[model samples]
Target: MAKSGPNYKVNGKEYYRVSLEIGRDATGKRKTKFFTGKTKKEANQKKQEYINKQILGLKDTKTLWFAQTFNSWLFEVVKMSDIKPTTFARYEGLYRNYINDSPLACISIDKIEPMSIQRYYNDLFKKQKKSSSQISYLNKFIRKFFNYCVDCGYIVNNPCSGNKISLPKEKRSEAIAKKVEIFTDDELNKMLNSDDCKIKYISLFSLATGMRRGEVIALKESDIDIKHNEIHIRRTIATTAIFDENNIKTKQTIVQEPKTKNSIRDIPLPNSLKSIIKKAKLIRNEEKFKAGESYSTKNLDYLFLSERGNFINAGNLDKTWAKFLKNIDIPHKKFHTLRHTYATKQFENDIPLKTVSTLLGHGDIGITADIYTHVLKKQKEKSVDILEII
Candidate 1:
């Protein structure tokens, strides 16, 4: 008698087998193939191999365009890969902005060659004048998509492989020559003394702690240990687009863990900053009282709240920073410049690199050294001046 189901005994030996439909034969008869192995896992693997071989042998795969294949890859492969929401949103944004309607996207997947991708990148840099960084991001997405295609037998090889593409030389050099920007001492002093209470407090807090904008806004009263003179960096507020079942996108602000374990560290709270924290608390209490029942109860422990009594929006923070700079008669700098300024000041004050790195919550001390190389060079100059005094 023949064995039943997936498990069977063939000549008194155990075996696992699976039957899969390959296609429909001529005259509409169903064609099937059996894959057998010692174990069910092995049998499944054999079945997948056969399916992949059949897909590779199909001539109709040449009809699959890049746009269609990209959508299929995104929903079927990328979406199921367990990436962060922010990262997925970024990938979606890159496809929409750079790849969706481009000429390259209209070509058949199998027809996409190295030079075809190279030309697309060249046009982005030369004709569109898009930055090298932007093109690099687009290239990364395209390369990953093509790699998936190759793995799934849609293509024989990835055109992006083997270093066949590169950015223009001048654009590459431009990106390499970019320098880290930071606020000057005078600018920092001006910002700390701003008449705008919100700006003054947040600026002082950021300058004092060297916290990222997201980390600062995500801070809660509970994270502060006044007796210990320590402030804990726990979480961050990120704004990312969330996609629903139907692929509809909505922007949302979410509190998430810090980017890395090193990002969650404790730093000593300066005595001067203590007074500012106290004042901020008093202001929040006053606002809560005035708003009464209307005050937002969500995340009430948050150290900073907008006028509407909700968590501060990252976009609104940036706009406020820009307006504050303009009002103070200072040249506009990114909010991140405050962080750089703090690190620079530390290096200038002869603080050890390791100590500075830990305070900044850098995962590696080398990262701290590289970013503040200019400051370290200046410190070296000061050391030479001391030698002269000796």
Candidate 2:
């Protein structure tokens, strides 16, 4: 509570004391520091020095350790932002896996340079054998972190501010990537009829609606309206690394909003599908009663459940799908192939591009266009046929 003051000594000498609020200690108690000087000016000067020391000390605490700064940004900035959990997890993963152990991690933020970062990336590609896309993701994280650094005034400018990272141009083999997998009609019917398909209804839902697996699992019974024959696209469920009670990161299933605004849509369900859903609801009644108090099903009237009457862990989907494929004597293909199959069927059925885009919840028509290039290529051939080209 005491303020700065100058005390006149008996010897006609002037001495001053300034109370510096150094904030609290580990406990909730307040801590204060006093600076004594031979003169008032000296006291003021000492107080200023203490203030700067405290500030620089904090700056060092954050900027000196790259991992600490990364976490600070994660908690203060990224987590507070509107980014999705998967996206936040992805950034965290990139930092932990690639950048955290880099030589740059030990250096102060202000001291890091474009060249140092560039060389770091180059080494990752050469020694670590990082792919272009993976390098690109790491570059993106660095850029975001450096931008945060600039915002915090740790650096005057972002070392990552210049030209966008130029990853090595991928060869055609890599750049082109693999064509999307689409299940044929025969394959779809085979899977549907196979008793070994544990997630048969899930596969059918995707094929009928072109919904993502995560989106389908996130659906609650409340989302389905049998009267209107409509299903609301609201949330998505994903299993990713999440921090536990003791701050230990662990893998868990998290339900969150859809990927994009357009992803939240309503689609009319076919009558047969509606009948199937009614039957499913009846089955879930028994599951809920069986699970009883142990059932962790909250307000979420989830359509699908494991044999244990719990939210289906989509993470196990790959292994489950593998078993299903083996049992059905089918070649290996991803579950997402069903979604592609749906989209392809829609386009092939002469559904308008925009209609298909909206139905698939694509952010833009271009994404639908890119994925269904087969439809466009066929249309081009039809154009040539119209002219009867020589």
Tell me how far the alpha carbon of residue 266 in candidate 1 is from the true structure, in angstroms, after superposition. 2.9
Candidate 1: which stretches are off by over 4 Å?
1-60, 169-177, 352-358, 361-373, 380-390
| Model number with the top lDDT | 1
* Model 2 bad stretches (over 4 Å): 1-65, 80-83, 123-129, 162-164, 196-198, 244-246, 286-300, 370-375
What TM-score fits each model? 0.77, 0.74
RMSD of candidate 2 to true structure, Å: 9.5
How high is the CA lDDT of each candidate model? 0.83, 0.75
Model 2, range 1-390, lDDT digits (tens) per residue? 898557645477667877877689888789987777888888778788657645664243233567667777876678777888788788878777876787887876766778888888888888887877788777778888888776665666777776834565457766456467887777777887776233766777888899999998777888888888898999998888775434477877788988889999999787757756766666667667887777665644688766556667776877887777787778888888888888878777778889989998999999888777766567666554545665
Q: Any idea what lDDT model 1 has?
A: 0.83
Residue-by-residue lDDT tens digits, candidate 1, 255-320: 888867899999999998888888887777888889988888887798888765887877888898
